[model samples]
Target: MPPEHNAGAEHMLVSMLRPLVERGHDVQVWLSRYGKAHRAYEYRGIQVVPLQARLDFGTAARRADVLLSHLECVPSTAALARGYGKPLVVVCHNTHRPSLRDVAAGQTALAVYNSLWMEREAELFFAEYPKAIRPAESLIVRPPVFAGEYATRPGKAVTLINCNREKGGRVLEQLARRMPDAQFLAVKGAYGEQILPALPNVEIVEHVDGAEMRERVYARTRVLLMPSSYESWGRAGVEALASGIPVVAHPTPGLTESLADGGIFVDRNDIDGYEAVLRRLLGSAAEYRLVSKRAKARSAELDPAAELAAWCDAIEQL
Candidate 1:
């Protein structure tokens, strides 16, 4: 686990593992590179272990029946699993350049994709490779959000989780200038700095832990904005929906799936269209109420227990 904090992948990992722990299944998280040394504590009954060196990988791998890995750790973990004769489960959290070496190695028993779009993307990326080189099994497991963790409040501002260019900082700047009457809250992210000029209406909030999202961000959010050019799955949109807040985002495949009827999808380049949609929602109480209801309804679709069961079933079969 490279990302120590403020990562959706890490948050989703914790959510999936917590239920397994409650069910009395021994679950442990081993961080390949430790950043938050002082913060290494048991989380929801699972011990967080930090590996000191590459040599420590074998010790940890030997203890686990199935090795689960994500992102940068996949290649090394895949190699280790091959050596240990353990089932390697690779979780695809985002769309990236598929490594031919890793996929062709035949070590991965399963590939767990976060979205159908991501799964399809992976299939396309590996289309040129021989069929035998691909992972034996592939499945879609949408990210889960605990609806009970969020609540509907009397919020009046439009919220954006991350303020980097990749997360649409330029769009935020344009929107802020175009819609001066609208209030926007931009939460800083780990990847990029805020380069947008200061605007009176847009308020920049410091990043908060995943546990504090409801209280710190969603509490004052009327609508969520996800103007990213690309996304495998938009976690912030679902988080907003859990709070009964509608999302206005670019019509990316992942966003379309996650937000569903709860979102008003506008084109990324259509600034005027974005403004028009926002105006309708903000200006009309009835429309906002309807969208809010839909948002909550959409949020209900993401059942953490169901997702955990799916993961458990996959692990059991593995």
Candidate 2:
């Protein structure tokens, strides 16, 4: 229900809901807090309504048949679903600390995890809670990506999507300094903006909408850098792979599963290792081409239509 920013979770929500609407499902998205000013709008035939208060939600729930809740809205949405005796489906976008309130709320809903690693973490987290507070059912649904949206092209620079400490902004700075000959492009993320003043070789790019990623970021990216401390699924890495650009990232559980053999995995703190792999890719055209081929092949496995169909099947059964 947050404004549809360039974040991966928001992108996934739009991609999934749009197709459902196209299939003749009368789907409406209700924002709990944000985007209240932009009260009503039609996006890809899906109606978005902003709920201002508890009363507004109660009124809306009376008209709705099922409740689909995101992470932040789980507590309130779960309470409403219970009150209305509706089936609640909670979509877990990331690995979050489970509070007693969240655990209690989860009991009344079916959980849909974005990745297998996330599902394992959620199960572990819920295991610490009382049995009565555990979710009724849980399922893993990898986030969908439109491979057609990206293109393979000649690239000249190494790109990092998000410039924040948690996202490996400092790692990018170090790499930029070590490889002065390599061009580094840092795309501004939703959080943190203090990266520009430190690194001279790294070019800072303003954040663009997800639809503009190919022309604005991937087209000029020889390799994608994802040095995040944690990742639920690594959406940017998947996007880069779709463009035939190899991702060099720390092997977080989500990134490891998403990239498979397509990525160049480096330890989170291994600056030397990252530099070695990147230098090899930049210096040898053959190596880059080989990795690009692997990247494309791996990306082909992600079929958006298939994923959407699976979602439809699951929702129908629910």
Candidate 3:
């Protein structure tokens, strides 16, 4: 699966829905897979439930005006929408089948692409396969990373949020070894096998929930190191920019589009390049300040106000 479908998708999904709730719309999230226990949880005014929760899906689907979902759950969620004749909004976080499967099948009434690249990928996919069902309408809403909630006084450690191989965990390890004197923070991701290095200068942090990310991680990060081999859109990188935190990242199309001029591009495999960039930031206050200013400016351009308003308006119109 793509890194975009990782926890970032969930965060982006919630960010999109939160606005609906604010605008007096009823919003609920049903967890597709969970332990056998019937349960429900809540976050930022959103009520989340397991499939067998007290408020069962059949009832929810039958009554729901519209269904919004993504990735692994899209298939079953799309089914509920079709069964109830409700509109389906599939948020595309990846170019892969799971994210676009329902969209391709024309099961989705409104398809929300998380990045321009992903939007194009879906377009190309449908164009290549003439028989596929196209979505009636489409829109691009990059993962909303609101600065107010995410911003904090930046701290010192060079941080990498997810330490999985595809997320450039190995690249982080190599960088850590090369720059022994520099401090590095390795954050264990909510999913995937973590490949953390046992280096003295590297402090390993346990996996954290989306709610805890602002305080527990970003507050302590000065630079976000995203060496991911594949990122549909690096939400974490944008989150860091909220606080004027510079990001050194691998040149993925998604990251390139989302971060824009905010990101310092580096080859993930080029440990030396990563080291040079990190060293320059550490050694030159002027360069760091310029990059930091650029990061903040970029974050402002991505303000969720207009994009979120459009998202809410579209969903509400349905």
Candidate 4:
């Protein structure tokens, strides 16, 4: 099932669905109450089902041939498959184990870490669990971005991204004050709106469709500013790179893996270091050009269709 407010999962679901439908496989989406009908309604030749029942596995399983669960929380579907002799495939979006507190209380176990970084984190957290109760068929399949419009000549526009409370809005406020000439566009909510008073350069935008978001934000963005406290895949970083733009991110756990070699990573606490890197990149056209080229190259390296095919192969093997 899809999360209520996650664009990353929406992109992944659509990416997987398109290919599966083309290959003559039936596709269905089990979504939460909050999930938008726009995507499910917009798809061509696919069955989109909204699930209203809470953990009604027997009911959901009987409607479909194979079940592809989006997150570990939906392992109830896996349990259903076990009971009904149906095939179950679970997708891992992040690698961080639920906090120790959650595990100690005997919560769900299956998960998919989007990067090698997250997979390692998960393995360490589940060290105490017996091999049998732990994630048995989890694998990393980094999220993909659909390539859309991008700036032919990126100007001084720098994107400041943070959707939730933990996304380091304070750091961005400081940067906005220092870099008065730079423009900022962020995914806005009540949590992010509070920062706008301190950040005049930043524009708060409503969550938009991925393709539209790419054209409006990613296309013109010269650098994607990722000061995230915790990011599983750095969706903004990957999207910016796919748009031929470089990223400047804090060296947070999941952000580091997503921006590796594709962009710059500054120590999270080193405010001075972050500023210096941004200034250096902006000042040097040659360095910016090189990094920009590499960013786009890296984005193209992860093919969504290819990744989904690989995931399908793994599921088939099981």
Can you give the TM-score per candidate against the true fold? Answer: 0.91, 0.90, 0.95, 0.80
lDDT (Cα, tens digit) per residue for candidate 1, span 56-170: 6578788789888887888888888988899998888877675434554678788878887887777777775556477888777787788788765838998788888878788
| Candidate 1 regions with alpha-carbon error over 4 angstroms | 1-4, 51-55, 99-104
The best-first sequence of candidates by lDDT reads 3, 1, 2, 4
Summarize candidate 3's per-residue lDDT along 61-172 as a digit string, tens digits: 8988998878777888888888889999988888886566568777888899988899889988888888889988888899998798889998889899889999989988
168-209: candidate 4 lDDT, tens digit per residue = 666666776788877766655323443553466877766555
Give all candidates' CA lDDT scores. Answer: 0.80, 0.79, 0.86, 0.63
> Residue 190, candidate 4: how far off, in angstroms?
11
Alpha carbon RMSD to native, model 4: 4.1
lDDT of 1 at 75: 87
lDDT of 4 at 199: 64
Best by lDDT: 3
Model 2 Cα lDDT, one tens digit per residue, 1-318: 334456788777877787778778889887765543455777657787755423376787777777888857778877888888887877788887753346446445567788888777776766765554666776677888888887758488988887888888888888899888889998888656546535667788987777778898999899999988988899889888888898999989999999998998999699999999999999999999999999999898866677678777767666
Q: Give the TM-score of candidate 3.
A: 0.95
Off by over 4 Å in 2: 1-4, 35-37, 50-55, 99-107, 130-132, 197-200
Clashes of each: 0, 0, 0, 1
| Candidate maximizing TM-score | 3
Alpha-carbon RMSD, each predicted model: 2.4, 2.6, 2.6, 4.1
Which window of 10 residues has the lowest lDDT sum in candidate 2? 98-107
